[model samples]
Target chain A: MSLLRKGQQWGTFACVWHIFDATWQDPFRSAHLIKKYLMGLYKPIYHPLNQCGDHVIVINSKEIALRGDQWQKRVYFHHTGYHGGATWTLAWELHSKDPTMIMKKAIYSAMDGTLQRRFTMQRLHIFPDDNVPKEILENVSNQIKQLRPVPNRLHEIPQEERDKIPRLIQYPSDYQLK
Target chain B: MAALYRVLNYLGKNVVLTAQNRNISLSAVTRIKEIIQKKEGNTLTFEAVIKPDPYEGRFLKPKNGACAICSSGLDIKHTDVLILSQFVTSEGNILPRRITGLCETQQKRISSLILMAQYAGLMLRRSPKGGLLHPLQKRKWKKFNSYYDEKTIKARYK
Candidate 1:
């Protein structure tokens, strides 16, 4: 094979590392996108039996946002294999116990329940904050886009930018100013 | 003759007495003013000056008879704090339709969006302090981040 063709083959098969920011992102929705990278579904030569999956490192797992009242309404079930050992934990309670547990469980449940599921999960790394190990951080070459843009708080905006927005309504001449 | 002489003496002094009629009410007065007190020589003068509008000619106006929000055709979400803040008072209360000039449906929609933004903690500065806890300090699940879907708002106009 030509040298250029050999280089392209090596590039196609090489496993890459991707980074994702979970700040204000919906974990369930993000799981679907992360699953694609974890299983290497984007690869042109991907196969069910092939080991072409890439590694995904998620940062700010604690900041993952849920839609509506999911934090209070969603429940996580646990069983200790004993009589009356089954327990239900609310999403917020689970998050308080371990910040990364919700994010980890989200990605784990997103994939199919196969024998390789556990093995595939080993390639996923989740951090509660941005403090990733140097060795792992060195390998990340790409970043996965967030599902939704993070909203800005009104108090956090600077005074100059706040002054620039056009006024939509003018108070009546006789209206009292609060 | 003595009573006429007393009246002539009072008129000769050139003193003018004026009684200004004012209505007293429990509600706040709409006329906002800045009171300025000036002392010159031996006389003190008090003046109530009307405050000027900061956004005089720059107000967003719709060309047609439609409301500004409807005419602009901007798909406003709860995250758009800049636009949403315009429809609220300094205390974060939604302005009345008479002052906002928004249609009934648009008024209802904007109010709902403001509520969602408050729950999400995007417009905490404008929120009124009624409860014991501060608006910035949320408890339990309320502290966490949450978003809303605009379609979930039930502002149906028949």
Candidate 2:
């Protein structure tokens, strides 16, 4: 009952701005959300041809997750249309080089193959971190909830709680976790 | 016309060559004789002087100096002016300059800015009710009902 209280308004609005925090969420899930929001599928006024999609701002794209084994097994293929131009890159390596590349590609391929797909894709904004411009921040009217809550960093946990957790063995007296 | 030009050309050449000699041709003196002689091949006739196109040289200046939105010192990214403006339709179609009262450049800027705003989560793009067609274009039940009435229904059933 409490979860239903925060349900988004589903009415057809002329314009809406949405923000998403990509931290620790699956990149595929984030891409799906971005595609859905960009096409404005959640609204009643959504039409395949109509440019009724809303804009979505995605921050912390660098921290997006991949399902187990995908990071090592997934390979992105590319060719430069020249001799010996074919290249294969592992997912983790590609993500490290350009944090937004995977998500961008996911959303790009997910959209319908129409001329308007290019235009709709323009509505997705991705940032590697939380540092969005002040002007863009001011315009964000809504937040798209993440599929999972962000895990707390070790430093954020209370000192007493850390000490209370039982361990099979203790490190040397000189050892420092930091 | 060629003969006349030839005559004028020869006469000038002869005059330059025979400046000391006054032995000029009688045909050259008579203007009627020059007009009567016709050249064997095509003779150059009327050549009309063409006027240059008026609009060709003119550059269009936007009505009040620079673009309307730019002149007002409103930064598209920082300000909500574009989002607040009614220049864009619910389906993200930009209104024409006539309705928006903006110059051509500004209209383009507004459109791009609106798109940017939409992507940045600052604005919404929505479609009008019942798509682009007007309500009047929709067929009235009485008008369209006849097509699907008894005769057609019977034909399909049969």
Candidate 3:
């Protein structure tokens, strides 16, 4: 495997490609992580406009998880440039309408505005699902892991396996655990 | 014969001409159109002029050059149409080249620019539309807004 600096920049001239998979992860947190990488914060030679950022590919955005009541509290507003064209939609509604919007917005907002900011943003790629085209996928040199692992669902645990666990304590005769 | 002569005298010049041209059979008023044209000559009407086509049976070809932004020398990053809106749909998928009407090179450029914008939080990736609520989510905030008489939420954050 080549070193980060060598692989990212070909003799200090070319940009590197960095692909990521974000399936079943919180979009807010993942976006933050992506923004850091985008600015080359991790590199010692990081600068504002040297074009040091690597290309990032994100997949399975549809499975993004939102913590707590953010879905209800968050709202996006827009206008149609006409009389009474103002519209407001809840976070969840927008997610259903476009699965990849949140992550893209989060990443876009996190980066600082600079001369290279626009060029940097173009390196980021996001998909709602894992249906990326083969031509694009071929350029992926590495994968950025999710910040947190998604917890397994209750249904995913088999009934026979659940029954095998030992009981910690017995309930009182008059008290009902149910 | 005497009655016919009286009728001809009443009809005057037209009758006299008809009688003179009896061998030719019908009067000018009731004569066949072809016979009338043959007699009057075909000089009254103009013939259709046939001109050569400029395009030679071919339609105007579509431009297969660089996209509007690239051709105009305006960077894709500065253009919201390519970065924040036009290139991507509300559902967060990249619009196809056919719909965007961009040439292959420009389409590729815009696609990269969009990804860059997304990475920088200049454009949205995930849907702004949130998921379904459990009816109890953010209940306190909702009630607080109602009690405070804050009906319009426009420009609240701005």
* Candidate with the greatest TM-score versus the true structure: 1
Model 2: DockQ against the native? 0.00
DockQ scores for all the models shown? 0.38, 0.00, 0.00
Error of 3 at B36 (Å): 99
- Per-residue lDDT over A1-178 for candidate 1, one digit per residue giving the tens place of the 0 to 100 score: 9999898788669898999999999999999999999998998879888999999999999888889999999999999999999999999999988999999999999999998889889999999999999999999989999989988988889989988888888877766555
- C-alpha local distance difference test of each model: 0.85, 0.58, 0.56
Q: In candidate 2 chain B, what residue range of length 10 has the lowest lDDT sum?
A: B142-151
lDDT of 2 by residue, A1-178 (tens): 4545435443365567899998768777667777888998887767898778988998988777665346667799999999999999987778878888987888898887898999998888889889999998898889998986553423235666544432212222221111
Query: How well is each residue in B1-158 modelled by candidate 1, as lDDT tens digits?
Result: 99999998787664542222223222346465345669999987756556887776668888688888888888889999988988887767778899899988999999999888888888854434442223458889998889999999898444
List the candidate 1 regions with Cα displacement exceeding 4 Å. Answer: A1-8, B1-49, B125-135, B156-158
Q: When superposed on Cα atoms, how far off is each prediction in RMSD?
A: 8.9, 32.2, 30.9
lDDT of 2 at B87: 51
What TM-score do all the candidates reach, one by one? 0.84, 0.45, 0.47
Candidate 2 lDDT, B1-158, residue by residue in tens: 99999999999998887664533233323211111234556863322222332222332233356544544554433124223334555445656665455656656666665544333223444435633322123221211100001121111211
Model 1: lDDT of residue A154: 84
lDDT score for residue A150 of model 1: 89
